[model samples]
Target: MELSRRIKSLPRYLFAELDRKKQALRQQGRELIDLSIGDPDLPTPQGIIDKMSEEIRDPRNHRYPDYEGLLEFREAVASWYWRRFGVSLDPSTEVMALIGSKEGIAHLPLAFVDPGDYVFVPDPGYPVYRASTILSGGIPYTLPLREERGFLPDLRDVPSEVAARAKVLFLNYPNNPTGATATREFFREAVAFAREYDLIVCHDAAYSELYFESPPPSFLSVEGAKDVGVEFHSLSKTFRMTGWRIGFVVGNAAVLSGLGRVKTNVDSGVFNAIQRTSIWVLQGNMDGEVEGWRQELRRRRDVMVEGLRSLGFKVEPPKATFYLWLKVPEGYTSRDFAERLLEAGVVVTPGVGFGEWGEGYVRMALTVTEGQLREALRRLREVKL
Candidate 1:
């Protein structure tokens, strides 16, 4: 049996590879302290859960839901965007529900990118961005995101030829792997670049609500961003609803419609009960919930930063997202360092898992309890990286 050429070219998924190693270690009776994935250990708010429970009992909700989503949920997302970012959207056309932001990010290329068309992807980006592009038979132009440039790819640095064939550009901030957040000015420039190049901009704002000091900026906040851009938002990070698989894509009507068409062919819709719960999560004033999570994350961030520093590693407390992007110590690759940490009972993601440019660093997610975090730090300090 022959496999598809496109599928053959793709690398094994980062987390899947990590899971294989983790499971092997765990099977050996090693108590693995997993900090590799960015999954929140916090519980979902009770209000949202209660709403889901009530909706689940309704016989009507058991039927197939609309592919676009429930009108109430769409309207709630629109209203949330308007109130949170002051970006007005037409719920009827500009908003489409997704199983999760990852679904949208992975399936979107099928809607807009033709085979052989070029996509500008960050070198140290979330792997799905590049994998999706490859799976669609589209060429991915990796723009190296270097520390000197604040982990952002400079559009001006893109070669003229690559820019000419580029149809889509992917941006994420409060970035994964490297928790670098983009400023409004940078986003404005990106919007302008997309407009000038006649490219579609896909902004993955999954970590928008996980900020520490200032709220992360939405792509829609920039002037005319909606003209050439679509942004993906997820309830996973914001409302601790990772398992719910609810998220939204907001922007140009044409792009939303195209994505909706792709979705209709592949998936029916997210569960109605999840949609109703999402409506409650978005519309209600969950200020207390947000504040509580932020404070706890802040304390964890300080401890991890200080602990890593004491081990003679340079680590900056990320301004947003619960990840620590630490540079690999001398003479060790990111993969090797990660393996060493795992052997010492700590599980962290290797930078090389994200991209080649990410090879010199490692990402540690602060998704464990304070005591567990301290214990991981102690074990890390003993490891000879």
Candidate 2:
């Protein structure tokens, strides 16, 4: 009756820890303003819902689906990539639908990582990146994201030996926790680095649709990007379809073939009905609706950032993503500051929970109403830290 080493190795999951604190506060009968996890509070679009409801009525969707995905769904994914990023993908060979971007991300390492192999991962990154490496018995080499560097990983700092030993390099933009976006030049540099090292590049572009000012650029938009990497896009954030759990990976045919092989062995693909609905979502022109979402998010971001600044906390409005990364005041650790805020009835994620490099900051997701955000700011006014 021994627990597996893999399970034992994991620290408490980020959101779970926040939930525990929240429950403790609730038991104490405290009114709480939670801004912790990035789960959007927005409603899914009517068009997507209507499509799903229609599909669900047909018994054809009740059966098991193709392990790779429906061809039409893959085709829709290809079309979206072309329209959004100007990147062309062959649906037959280059696209594999995912249960969600998180599923694809967690399972990708298992496809390629060998026991004891090294992976180039960003510290202060999505927890699943490091967790997946560890679950696959691979070592995660930390690439710290510092604010002065615009929170981008410094690929040059990687030792040649590490690069030679690494099997994959995982990147994300607009990044979660950090809310930093990568540029075309940075993605080009990344592709060159991956080429030199002969490794897989897993680019998570889940937040690409939630940009504030302009649409975020896709890694595949960079020249030769598809030669060395795969880009993961989500239907979740883009269309407020988080619970729908549909996304797709596109790029190098060989890389996708391996990932698809792994997926086929693991489980059946996303529900056929869901895939049909996703096709509907992708086929439609989403700019107007998505732009409305961006404008609302921008409004919320301004409220949160401006309020934090007025409270004497230094922070900048993020250009992409729905997160606001705030530096902890002098003499306060990330957890300490976050804990103080929790005690004061405001819940936010501690940056240190992201990784060692995140020691001096906290992350607040703008997934709440403007009134709730304003109220959270009012709650924060109690903490002098």
Q: What does candidate 1's lDDT look like per residue over 301-336, in tens digits? A: 999999888888877789899898999888998888
Please provide, for model 2 over 1-385, each residue's C-alpha lDDT reduced to its tens digit, 9 standing for 90 to 100.
Answer: 9999988886666556657888999999998887886888889877777888999999999999997889999999899889878989899999999999898888988889998899888989888899999888899999999999999999999999989999999999999889999999999999999999998999999999888767789999999999999988898887888898888889999888888878989979999999998888788755677878888999999999999999998898998999999999999988878888998898888898888898899989899899999999888887776
What local lDDT score does residue 13 receive in model 1, on the 0 to 100 scale? 66
Name the 10 consecutive residues with the lowest summed lDDT in model 2: 10-19
Clashing pairs in 2: none
In terms of lDDT, model 2 sits at: 0.89
Residue pairs clashing, model 1: none
Using alpha carbons, what is the TM-score of model 1? 0.96
Query: Which stretches in model 2 have alpha-carbon errors above 4 Å?
Result: 12-20
TM agreement with the true structure for every prediction = 0.96, 0.97
